[model samples]
Target: MLPAEFDYAAPASLDEALALLAGGTNIRILAGGQSLLPTLKLRLDRPDLVVDLRKVPELSYIREEDGEIAIGALTTYADLVASDLIDSGVARCLAEAAASVGDLQVRNLGTIGGSLSHADPAADIPAAALALDASLVARSEEGDRTISAGDFFHGLWATALKPSELLREIRFRMPANGGGAYEKLRQAASGFALVGAAAVAEMDGGTIEAMRVALTGVSSGPFRLHALEDRLVGETLSEELVREACDKAGEAIESPLSDAHASAEYRVAMAGVTARRAILRAAGQWR
Candidate 1:
């Protein structure tokens, strides 16, 4: 399908992109264009202008400084998968999720910032973001502000980013201890998650000290299973216990999606299954 005519600008600098965004009321920012381009072609979105950020070199890097790891918004899924920094320890789940997204071509073209900004309910990245307790940095003419991953995702195809804000970077606190893992059931056709779970856990004296479990593809948005986490913490983790705790995975979801690929009930049930697997894997009790 041919897209509606729109003025386009490829900005080499973020400031120029910000200027374009501020100057236009109906404008779209194009990162990898894996998601936005499809919407444009379908005429689901008819922006007056599109500001391409591909030439913005500063927004495509991965760096670790002090106690934080900062990843540019333009960092692609392929970059994440190939990164030694993301392949193990705390950020492993994020890499796992990135590797699971679509195929080789999609991974090469899909940006972490673009994926999170699009906020697709079935996306693989958001669950990892939630588990990692990531922070998103948004830049605008006003300056930079940070948004926690918990507050960043609003609902289906929605995020906290304002029209004038460009997602600059995603930041994660360096993993002091423990490990994390991502687990998902893919939708056969699109490779989107039927139910995706991410879990990060720190153990003490062979018991669960701290843990985070997050799920996507079953709700209006990806969300942390705090209720379940709270229950499992301080308890010696076991297959039986994790299985029991994860039964509450769907209890916190206000709106579970029901689509042709999977029913709400099926998703809710799989939520428990995936969450349990992720939790056990992260805690090092499962392989």
Candidate 2:
């Protein structure tokens, strides 16, 4: 289906983009357009103007500063996969997730910020960001605010971003002596996750010092299994302990969504399985 007619503007600067957004109530920012274009074509959204961020050169770089990684809003999934500065474990996990997003073409065109802003429950980045304890930087006419990944996602297809605001960058403290992994049950057709898990573990003398486990596709939004993390912290990393952590994670999810690909019960079960696998992989048990 064809989208409704709309005015398009590819702003060369952030201020111009902001001006376009501030000028109208119905304006959509086009980053990667992987998600937005489809929604527009389906007529799920009708915007008076489309503010293309692609030409905003400032929003497309990755840099490391003060022991944290900063990714600009326009950074593509493929860019994240190719960055050598990111930890090997985290990069592998992100690359795997990015590669699974639709296909190579989608990965090359899909922006990290676009995916997060879309807030698709089954998308891998939200869960991965949660596990990494990432923060989002959003800018608007009023000012800028940094929101934790946990608070950034409000619900299914929802986010903390105000209509007038644009997400600038995503920042997170790089882990030390820790590794991470993302595991997902993919839909054969779309390659989107049916149930996905991202796990990060910090080991001190072979004992867990800190741990984070997050899940997607099982709930309305990506969420960290804090209860399970608490149980794992200070415990030795082992198959048995990982199993227990995964079980706790499965039990912690209050509600799981049932979709065409999988039932709620199946998602819950897969969440546990994926969580266990991801944690083990992060812990270097499975390499």
The residue-by-residue lDDT of candidate 1 on 213-255, one tens digit each, is 8999888889999999999999997899998888767777777
> Which residue pairs come into collision in candidate 2?
none
* lDDT string, candidate 2, 76-160, tens digits: 9989888876546454555556656888899999999999999998899998889988899999877789999989999989999
How well does candidate 1 match the true structure in TM-score terms?
0.97
Off by over 4 Å in 2: 87-92
What lDDT score belongs to each candidate, Candidate 1 first?
A: 0.91, 0.86
The reply for model 1, stretches above 4 Å from the true place, is none
Q: What is the C-alpha RMSD of each candidate to the true structure, in Å?
A: 1.1, 1.3
